[model samples]
Target chain A: MIQDIMTVAETAKLIEAGNVLLLAGDEAVLRQLPKGNWIGGTIPYFISHAEGGLATRDRIFVTDVTGVAQSVEIVERDANGLAKVYAEGPQEGFSVVIIPALSKAHLSFALNAPNYKDFGVRPLIGWISGVHLDDLGKVTPKVFNGVTGNALEEGAVVLQATLKPGKVAEVGIVNLFEQGGGDILTFPADGFSAKEVLVNGEKRNFAAYIVKNKLDTRLPLVADYYGALVNISFQGIDEVEGEVKFYAPVFTGIRYKHAKPVADYGEAFKACLENKCQLSEDRVVFSCNCILNYLYSGLEGKKTDPFVGPITFGEIAYQLLNQTLVYLEVHDV
Target chain B: MDVPSMSRPQWTDLVTGKKTYQLKFLAAKILLGRLVHSVKENPTPANIKSCIEQVYNVYAKNAGSPSVQEDLTTIFG
Candidate 1:
């Protein structure tokens, strides 16, 4: 896998060379690339091979898929058009999608992806595009369609890549946090923000409940989706409004518990990878970790070896996830 | 376990937590989660069948695999 940070000139060369690529960089840098077979999302933060976690706008992180992909098709879809995302993807291949942060497409995908037609039938993996933390409200995040050289802020740009014969793509996640032995939390409806929640079967103000328990907001609410431990990270709480906002929507009928505290995020993440993930480093085509992990764990210059890519706003395995590391690997059968 | 011999009520029991069966596969778990939520609201035959068809759609690519076939039989039969 050709995954690394390169200068804009070098990235443009790869694009011109017709290599199927998934590029991540500053919006300005990505806008400088030539048109070709690729899709790009704006983000300055990344966990690079040379430097573990660093933010740079001058270079782009490129994942060259020319070797693994037999053919690649780029599609741009709005919130409603995203309904066809999985249904339209190559039957035998995987998709890489990039939706701008805070866009309608992002909200729609996070809240309704589970109900999408053929949802989870095929491997769909990607990240939510975001600007520099400093530029959060100043500049909107954008995704680029290399085919048309168009950047979009309201929809998603997807790369539907058909893999080589006998090769299969698999998406997996590494979540360091587990459900703690805390009160069972349930919400009344599916949404990203909530004012009320059921705590151990009792109705309570969601924000007040968190404040009363002195919960560490950095840790996400973990739920067991079958064997998969899904995470919904905390975005913020409005004390005046008595509302708690989450990076991903919390669904009704799902039981959630505050995640157990981690003594050291860097060490725990590395250990989880070594123990839980049996990955062939070379076979890993792409991987990305949540930006929340980067901020909370102070990942600057710290390496989560064997897995590295963009430090994104949110991650997507089959659906939107938060405070987790998601990766895609190809295996020959 | 002769899962195919189980009745709709038994399957509902498993999903609704009246019974238990360890599901294998993320897709199965996800589909079952949706089914459980839907059945709780309205367990009409049409709704149950629709949810069952979704589970089958996800496993359509693996329809030939013995484990997938068994799971389909266990959940839908």
Candidate 2:
């Protein structure tokens, strides 16, 4: 059922079967697929069901839906589609979203994501599609709604699947990184950029503090906000400005209760999978991991037990996440 | 089939063939560092076995390195 680099002829068969699919492949290959009930994005990296990973431009990653989708729609800022989903999303199955990477919509969604959290939207699970490593700069990332063939980069293709009667879908994340209790680092102001921060009450340049202390950028900064563990992942360090950029903006208003460093990435990752995957294998329907984890933990070929899918630029469970595995599991209610 | 023991250039040649596999090799080195560190710390019979399996999993799974794959099967089995 799991295949890499599928031929157009083979893909045509899946389309004919009327199955709902989530696809990952090159733009040309994806373009060749017959329009049908599917949503896809561009990416060559995949965590397949075959106990390892694969990166291929010739093939596509396809996962067929177990149940027929009740409804499907493409949401775009131009169409006010996200608002519609927020108001009318199904109460049963989760909404599957595939967003193109680094597009205007992607940035808009990431920044305004907290607003969606407040609106009580349906369970959302998805990833940002990306260009192949070789095509990173040459081509823009694209998402596809098989019903529409190709979609604008700045839009999200969503499928609202209605789980079979009596079936229920649950979304969750498996994060291996826990606070290693290092220094207490906090930004003085709310927003994504923290040029200077309070390192245990001492003002210091964020980038300088990281390099001087040799802090592990891979682990991310963990904040305990009202008992909920929210991880603010490191995006990059601006050397000239001495500013630290984050995947998700850190709010100054919310006190960072503590700062956690990843103890040991490889061991922590392995242990987390070992502990969580024992029961999730049979229930998990679809899953995707953050590319940060893929690069930092060296997971190119490593098996993450029951979790597998695309290694995306970013992962969305309800909101954007970094260095974590997000999955949707279904069971009969 | 002696992948772990092979010299860097030899291994790269075997894995990459005539083409350059620079990006793939760069990714491998990062994982290899962790594997080496883990093996050094434990070195237990069980630990060594698991670490070797993981190293192969992370570095050589889709590496197109037939000898390395063969070696992995032989060593683990």
Q: Residue A32, candidate 2: how far off, in angstroms?
A: 1.2
For candidate 2, what is the lDDT?
A: 0.64
Residue A116 displacement (Å), model 1: 1.0
Against the hidden reference, what TM-scores do the models get? 0.92, 0.73
Could you give candidate 2's per-residue lDDT for residues A1-333 as a string of tens digits? 333336567777888887778787888788888888888888888877574666777777777664535555544342235544433556655687777877766776665654442232355688888877778779989888788676667778777786666665556677776666678776778666789888888889989988988877776787643223556788789888898888766765343423355455557767777774444466777888887777777777787756778888888776666677887766654
Worst 10 residues of 2 chain A by lDDT: A113-122
Single-chain TM-score of chain A, each candidate: 0.99, 0.88
The DockQ values of the predictions, listed in order, are 0.39, 0.01
Model 1: what TM-score? 0.92
Model 2: pairs clashing at backbone N, Cα or C within 3 Å: A5-A59, A5-A60
